[model samples]
Target chain A: MAPFAGYDMPISYPTGAVEEHNICRRGVGLFDIDHMGQLIVSGPDADAFVSHTVSGAVLDMKDGDARYSLLLDDKGLVLDDLFVYRLPGRWWIVVNASNLETDVEWFTLRAREWKGTVKVEDVSEATYMIAVQGPRALELLDLMGTPKASSCPRFTSGEIVIQGTKNLFGRTGYTGEDGGELFFPAQDALGLWEGFIKAGETHGIEVKAIGLAARDSLRFEAGMPLHGHEISPSINALEAGFKWACDFSKPDFVGKKALEAIAAAGVSRKLVGIEITGGVPREGYDVVSPSGEKIGTCVAGMFCPTTKKYAANAFVEPQFARPGTEVAVMAHGKPKSGVVVKRPLYLPAYRR
Target chain B: MKIDSAARYQASHEFARKDGTVFVIGISDHAQEALGDIVFVELPEVGKTFAKGQSFGVVESVKAASDLYMPISGTVTAVNDALGGDPALVNRDCYGLGWIAKVEATKAGEFEGLLDAAAYEKEAGKD
Candidate 1:
């Protein structure tokens, strides 16, 4: 276990990361991601308040709809990435654990700016998040879960009544799998954990608890962005190639002015996937040209079990972001030959 | 937590056991267990020489890369070539088939200076 965002979390179970990763890819796997934070946004003028905070256009989302959006600072750089959910009475946002307090305070300040009509509550302390991912995730969940889990539309929040307790879940995950991120009370953490395990057993599937190590590798291979890795305070959404997250048509949002100006001027750097051989590439490693001239920096790399290649995500000059472009990654003080490729190296079941 | 009683261990976790004129070198079972799944192993070429406690090669797991230290001054005699294709052997049989390399010891006295099974076991527990 290691300390992350003030929480001591498991890097992997005794079964190891490689096995845990493979299990999530093929069968069913569970991740105790309670370290993530949740918040409820509501009250009069909430639409205007949320619209002013996030880069995404959240007003049009129907109830139960969820959107992956960016929380940007006025300077047009990402402050955090969040999942904004449209509940019946309020907007439920899931933010990164490391930025929980800052995000809550940001919302509180923004609400105050609106004359205190908007309400922002920090519900993270009472929440628990479990990611159930793989091809058979919903099936495994439906065995004992209520409210017909599969009926939960993909990419949206759905309700599940567990022993009369209401839980919110979304058919979404960082790993490239057909699964849901289950959100419920922290007090029911044990019951939900054991329920999933028992359900997995009933289906003849081993529901292993995945750790942070495999969680990172799976996200890296799926072309998903991490807080400190891909999208940080210094890295803007456009530079990270998350243009879709930024809705330029939205009127009056934080960072909208700067982001629109950048879009008009075009992004300087681009993010791309690289398959490296001879060594493993890691965060902050230089991406160099054939002559060893520094071209970019690697964000993360790992052994991609699906592709059977050592894959990495790097931000490089736009000229080298094309697929099949030859590159090299400086790994362990040595340059390892690499080539740029399209991301999401392992295709997700939902996409297929 | 299993230890091969016949081998002597370096504090860095490499184990060396004298075999005729050569000494078989591999990481301890404790080290392999801590490393989780081993994905790649880089070993020194045969005939390369190193001083005691010097880094000879690298062993990579899914998590990170770690340097393998020489327990005693020796010249590389042979490297386990099968690791090139399947490095998980290190996780499965670290002391037997997973032996990293065979070395012709140049400073034989260094082996005796290393920790015995009982002492190494006690040290491993502390970690």
Candidate 2:
């Protein structure tokens, strides 16, 4: 186990990261993601507060829906990426574990500026999250007779009962596969995890506990942005290729004016997918052009278990971000040739 | 977990076995286990000469990359070509099918300075 976000987290299971990654891609894998922060926002001004703070169209979301959104600073730089789930009377915001305290403080301060009633509560300690991901994930859940697990569509959330425990089930995951995330009382975490494993066995699906290593590789293959690696305080949503999450059509929002100015000026750098030909490219490696001019830096790089190739997500000049554009990555002090491909190196099989 | 009794070990977790005049070299099982999933390997080319303790290649796992050092002064005779396509051979059988290279020993007497299986087990436990 390794220290991550104040929690002793497993980096991989006994079978290792490769096997765990294969399990999630081919079969089913379980992830204990309890370290993620959960915040509850409700009141008369809840919808207004959410719309004002995030870069998503929160006011248009119906109940039992979830939207991927980002919190940005005044300078239009990202503070963190989050998922805002609209329940019956409240909005549940899930943020990165490392940004829990800062996000809570940001939300609390913003809520005080509301003219109507608005209350923000940090419920991270009382909540636990588990993700079951793979093509067979829903089949295993169906065998378990989990209510709403099979019916929930992508980016949707609903209440469900698992092993007699009430929980919030969301059809969302980091891996580019069909899966659902379960959020329930912290006390029922172990029971639900064990029960799901046992239920998977009945359906011939070998559900194995996955660790942070596989989780990272799976998400990286899907081209999902991680907080510290892809999007950070210095990186904006436009450059990170998250313009879809930003609802510029809204009248006004936090960082709206600055983001509009940035959009008008055109983004300087763009995040592009790179396939390494020679060696693995790692973070902080310089991306160079054909003429040996430095272009950008690699933020995340790894050997993709699915593609069986060394791929990376890098920020490079807009001219060098097009697909099939030849670029060189400095690996082991040598310029290894590669090409900038489409944004997502791999596509999610179950995306609707 | 299986250590060859005939192989001599280095404190850095490399193992070398005398096979005629050429010595078979590879990482220990413990080293492979510590590296998690072996993904890529950068092997030294044949005929590349290196002194004792010199870095000859690199082994990368899903977690990080580590340098592989020469156990003794020798010239590379051959590298395991199978690992170029299937690096997991090191994790499955670190001592046998996963052998990294065969080297023609320049100083045969250097074998005497290497730790035996028993001494290696004792030293590895201290880690």
Best candidate (score: lDDT)? 2
Can you give the DockQ of every candidate in the order shown? 0.65, 0.78
In candidate 1, position B13 carries an lDDT of 96
After superposition, the stretches of candidate 1 with alpha carbons farther than 4 Å from their true spots are: none
Model 1 C-alpha lDDT per residue in residues B80-112, reported as the tens digit of each score = 998877788999999988999999998899888
lDDT by residue (tens digit), candidate 2, B1-127: 6788999999999999998889999999888988889998889999999998999988989888899989989999999999989999999999899999999999988988999999999888887
Give residue B104's lDDT in candidate 2 (0 to 100): 95
- What is candidate 2's lDDT per residue for A2-92, written digit by digit as tens? 9999999999989799889989999999999999999999999998889999998988889999889999988789999999999999999
CAPRI quality band, candidate 2: medium
In angstroms, the error of model 1 at A9 is: 0.9
| Top of the candidates by DockQ | 2
